[model samples]
Target: MTTTRTADPTAEPGAPSTTTQASLYQQLRAHLAVLRLYDAAEHLPAVLDAAIAEGLSMTAALERLLAVEVDATEARRLAGRLRFACLPTPATLAEFDYDAAPGVDRALIDELATCRYLESATNILLIGPPGTGKTHLAIGLVRSAAEAGYRTYFTTAADLAARCHRAAIEGRWATTMRFYAGPTLLAIDELGYLALPAEAAAAIFQVVSQRYLKTSIVLTSNRGVGAWGEILGDTTVAAAMLDRLLHRSVVLNLDGDSYRLRAHQARNETLRKTTTGTRKPLS
Candidate 1:
């Protein structure tokens, strides 16, 4: 015998008779919202359709969605860290003029870009003459650290000293010192540009001492270690600070003529040629 079944009167012509599918979708979206998985919730419908079309298993589809959320969250976190870093500008190792500063160890700089020293809390000392790309290299490494999920801060030596001095006057020296020492990588640029007062020098020494063996520092200086005493105005204090910083540090000495001066000279030469070309010939 053959039997025929009739459709339910409540069913729409082209729609499912049961509300189970709609209810399940609503529940899934509610759970996603509650769990703060906004990205997944937003993309769920399209992703689900694609997954079904591709014959993906439920677990595989879920994994793919979660991966997207994870990547977005990590990107936002890195952006926040970069904003807090206060770098002079965004720079990268690729932008450096390796050929111009042949004295600089390109291999060593490439290694530093890997950011392994950060894990060991090792310091980096970039010593070079003015305009020899010391600050550029320092800033590049700081940017790399920030991107690699390390807390980073950048400030010139004079500015840092002034800030510390002000903090001392305001009786917030400890707080300021903690701020400087807290970052995973703290870059101090132009360390020998200006002579610091005894009090300021002491404050800087305190920062080095506090972060000793615990955090990394990227220092760019125009003066050599021997001249630090005169720059800081205290030989004993300089010696103590150097001892702590150099214990686990990589010193990179950049020896080259000033890139800025060379650029200036080239520009002047071009302008002179242009002026001569435009002048009338002497009879």
Candidate 2:
């Protein structure tokens, strides 16, 4: 025995045709499916009507109904430029000894969530051996700061030098410096991995010197502090650059076996993927 219902004169245009209980269930299912809730949300009247007819808990029904809606709103909250979303959570978990430093306290990781130093224009330096989470920490902190309403820009020391060289040739060196220096926190990774030319060294020094007390920066490098002079290839310029950078900086020294080296030896390593691209294990 089926009952038919007439359409209301005030129904909205393009509204689903719901002339029967079955039709109403079908419309609801279609609406919910548009939001992608497909676990038994088929166009079946008995499924929905039975719940309502049996006086099931409305609270429970509404909870199930709005699951997708809550997830969508949360996804939008994490909307910031990310360098590498593929960074495994294991890197940030407590298993990593994030607190093994003096000035570079892991305690700051919690404090930095509020972006105080970034707001105050202080720089952070993560000095460590290769594959000891220098890049990971820098990227993580940049993501944290960016999510807290600060703009973040990431580049390697090599690419930065290359771009600066290009800008110099094009007579826009200052423009390029401002481009990278504009971010609330600029994450410059691998500062000493590749050798840099003299002019690139000076331009980089100029940028660092200018940002002193004016903006925040985060750098990760595999080279030791003494070797930086060699990497820059100009002892005088390197000294001056360090003067400005180390004035009020939090310096982190990471000392350990290369996590990368350990993984390669065991053959248990997985290639880490980044937004720019994927790289195989570096020897």
Candidate 3:
């Protein structure tokens, strides 16, 4: 039988040294050419160049590609946390308890995965007193949306407002707004925690207004519909904001004992070790 050189596994091929070039792409390309990986290296150049342009070293990019290539078995496991488009999805929905929202309708859970609405770019309002997993469920929903290969962006209302304010001061308002507005689904969490300045409120409202019927957003707030006017500080602005947000929106009113308080009690009980195995001092 004749042995073929291309199929030979023990070939001592020439290897390129990396002492000359300032970049990883040049070095890898040279090495690949020396090893006669011209066809394989064709794809590597573009991927490597893109990674380098994004400020990653050639070696680092190759390492990342190798990890991805070798972890083929983890393709399914990576689905939830990996393929997110606009929002980040959690690793699993199993950790969240839907039973906590006492008066909440079960229709909301069904709506969580409803991509048609999100693709149409509607709003999802998650309102609650405090805790009650409003943020958790919002985040979980956003995560699920992201895992399904939708682009997602997440921020607190305060953070988004502050960022917009800073951008205006820095004269980067247009650029910042363009970037923030481009996401397919933007999640604004913790809405009622801080009072936004008039300008900040206006900026945030502009974002909400611009997003109306154009993009989806997951809003988590601790305000009742009645109290939102006070939080926004301008009735007309608030009214307009409400008109934009509430239309085509799925509102989830989550109310119950504060999860923070329950967590505190649980932690205290766990630490209470005594001689009688009760609430006595450990000493």
Cα lDDT computed for each candidate against the true fold = 0.88, 0.70, 0.72
Rate residue 231 of model 3 by lDDT: 88
Q: Pick the candidate with the highest TM-score.
A: 1
lDDT of 2 by residue, 1-283 (tens): 9998687777543244556844775577787778675543542333345456667586765664465456554445555344332222323323345543333466766776567887678888888878777877777777777566667777888877888888999999778878876777787888998877777787788778767888888888888767778989988888888888888787878777676776686564333334226655679
The sequence of per-residue lDDT tens digits that candidate 1 reaches over residues 94-208 is 7999888998888999999999999899999999889899989999999999888899999988888899989989999889988998999999999988877678789889989
Which residues of candidate 1, in runs, are more than 4 Å off? 1-19, 269-283
lDDT of 3 by residue, 149-215 (tens): 6667788888888899899999998898887788678889888888887786688788987788889
Question: Model 3 residue 80 lDDT?
Answer: 37
Among these predictions, the greatest lDDT belongs to 1
Candidate ordering by lDDT (highest first): 1, 3, 2
TM-score of model 2 (CA atoms): 0.64
Name the better of 1 and 3 by lDDT: 1
The local lDDT score (0 to 100) that residue 96 gets in candidate 1 is 96
Report the candidate with higher TM-score, 1 versus 3.
1
For all candidates, what are the clash counts?
0, 0, 11
Model 1 TM? 0.86
